[model samples]
Target chain A: MQRLIVWSLAGLILVPAAWAGGDKKNGNDKVFKIEGTLAKDDPADKLRKNPHKVHEYKMKAGANYVIDMITKNAQELDPYLRLEDSAGKNLAEDDDGGGFPNARIIFKAPKDDTYRIIATAFKGVGDYTLTVRVASEAQSILEQLKESLGTKQKELFKQFPAAKTEEARQKITDRFYELTADSLLPLSEFAQKYADDPAAKEAKNMVRNNLRQLEQSDSPGVGKVLRTLREKGPKEMHGQVSLALSQNLRSQYERSYQRKDKDAGKLLKEIEDLLKHVGENHADLASQVKDVQFTLKNLTVGRPAMEIEAEDLDTKTFKLSDYRGKVVVIDFWGHW
Target chain B: MYPHERSLVKRLENSPFALIGVNSDQDREKLKKTLEDEKITWRSFWNGPKGTGGPISAAWHVQSWPTIYVLDGDGVIRYRNVRGEAMDRAVDELLKELEAKKK
Candidate 1:
């Protein structure tokens, strides 16, 4: 039987936790390294959504800490993390904040107390490496913003499936844009005030992440949001913003072509102009610019299908052009 | 997908149409069994042992499975990822165009 373990981490809970064991010291900073496994027989959380393991740690008041749950195979062990007060109150939680399938939580202790850290698998089961360390003040603020964004994004994703009507879906999408804008507006201000700060790169990344979501959702407010970000956001991020806009426009062009819309060529021209601007201004994105132009020139509707010459299951080689006289459906398929 | 493809191939058996698959199954022997069991009668090019990461998919920049591209008799790409009823309609419309051109 095939092991269908690999799956997209999109919409999956991305979080992390640590164990009480293996406390190590790195200078004045207390470093804790915990290795653990989540199995099928593990206890599920209160909501019974995920199987988890819990650990307790003594935390100092007003101190910032960064916790990460790193798994060897993200496809098998999608880690989630939660920090709770001694009284079991949820302080903060994260999923995919450490990057897809891994989890990280940045927490500032409210008071001197023992805090419970919960390690769980969002899906599947495997081993993970959990580490905890004191975070610098600057890193903590940025990471906290990311954690909060992750939490809200998680909540919105949960509500997405239950949204039956188009109106409800649109409302949720609008809320996503609002949340993203709320988080970014402050960062944008900070970036402008401290123009030379290295944090601007991080700010750019946040914008890129939100733009990615916007592309997938195709929200009606996307154009307005993109305009606002381009005008108000850090100049360092303009390249990614342009790239995302061109990509979104490419999708629109494809859809228009599929529908046989008369105005499809207009969108193509817009995309071409956008890419040209990116190419001249964003030198780093030159290769990507070339790739987009190549696809536009060769792979668009009404273009000749690119020839594929490869061996079949029987080891007999054939060319796609061999079946030129027939109407063909080329399916890129996998059993899993 | 197999069932629908089977039906489409059968429905248009007499027409100048073909359904070609770039299959990303890792195990070729297992895929052969699946092909037989699923009664898949169309031609498929193997995407090699690396499965989805193989050369064909990389060249095509195909990010998802079951990504369909419909091409006309002149080998011009006409539609993409149109499935089920829409897939049938796209194919039928192209075949009709071919018929119209013959006249």
Candidate 2:
């Protein structure tokens, strides 16, 4: 009995706790070290609604810091970094709309406080190796930091001007043809850096937040893609979109058939057909709709999976059974 | 909080925002540390009054960590699902009544 309890405890909580525990630096710098699978990929791992991977760390005020994320599992990761105090008011955040598994991030920590270095990723990547280094105020800025941010920020600023109409927005958005959303941060960095100055921080945050939202947006890029296919895409773009989500992503968009697209009637029909054909088709676009449905359906945090309960480190049991009658939103996620 | 909530939090400086923190998550210490680090002295919790005595899990049918619900003084649930910045907007709108009551 003792051995069983020990082993179970280790598997469920101890091991992951060990990995979450940070490695202390002797004097100045702080690094957040996560070394193993925190949760053995839950069946709902891919179904993660909010993909913002948050990391928390403590750094000396006014000290230079570097944060790096080197991933091993999900390769399609585009990561954005941020620093926040406990109050949830963002002290510093990068709208870089970016990535790096082995990226070397550099910044200065505010004086005399414990701040969290949040690591946010886009795309579906695997395991990760994140390194954050803190340097004395005396250390010089790295080459990347010293490089001219002004020119780059201006270029991105001009290129990413607010879209007047959804159509106009679509035109610029096409340039972001990423298969899984990892490398979209250059603009994000520009926005945050110039937030307080002449540049519009609200607009910048909008874009960064939009990208994050789009990653979790269940509306699927399908509707927009469908519109483009007929007007700008291959002659038979309709059939292709149908095949992509149903065949590859493992999902179906049935209600879409009721909706009319000036371009692809047959394609919409095909999508419905695919869903009907497979009682439970897990379409790729299902990811996009997950957030939509999660929000629209009003799901809460504890009620979705009431039956599955895991034991914590302390000798106590948690049963989802207790929260059955209340609204529950299920969330499977990680943070620093 | 998301954009909508950002607006609401701004309105509630004098009003109370029932910002309860549930830390019976995979990272309790981190959550506690987060509040302290951010200097957010908002009233938070570790799974209700069980207070580390046990894992007071989805008892209220919570599906997310940092999940929040607003119940009026009358013992009725005024709002159910709230989160991110939108959640801020939600509780803020409700707290507006408190401000009005004062007037």
Q: Each model's TM-score?
A: 0.66, 0.27
Candidate 2 falls in which docking quality class? incorrect
How do the residues A198-288 of candidate 2 rate in per-residue lDDT, one tens digit apiece? Answer: 2234334433443443332223453444334324432222233333333222111222321324434454445446444333344544554
Candidate 1's docking class is medium
Clashing pairs in 1: A14-A95, A14-A96, A15-A80, A15-A81, A15-A94, A15-A95, A15-A103, A16-A80, A16-A81
Q: Best-fitting candidate, measured by lDDT?
A: 1
Counted clashes in each candidate structure = 9, 59
DockQ of each: 0.65, 0.03
Cα lDDT of all candidates, in order? Answer: 0.79, 0.42
Off by over 4 Å in 1: A1-82, A87-104, A107-202, A212-224, B26-30, B99-103
First chain of candidate 2, TM-score: 0.30
Q: Which stretches of candidate 2 lie over 4 Å from their true place?
A: A1-158, A161-224, A227-335, B1-17, B20-34, B37-103
* lDDT tens digits, residue span A1-336, model 1: 133333324213221122222232322165777889988888887643788889888777777888899888887998889989899998888888787989998788889888899998777889999988777555666666777887997899899999997679878977786677567656666556645655556665666677666654334355556657767767877777777667666766777887789998998898899899999999999998888788777766767989899988777899999998889999999888
Cα RMSD (angstroms) for every candidate in the order listed: 12.7, 22.7
In candidate 1, what are the lDDT values of residues B1-103, reduced to their tens digit?
8889999999999999999999898888888878888898888888999999999988887888889999999999898778888899999999999999999
Tens digit per residue, CA lDDT, model 2, B1-103:
3233335445554454433334453555555565555554433334433433335443443445444554432223344444565455545554565456568
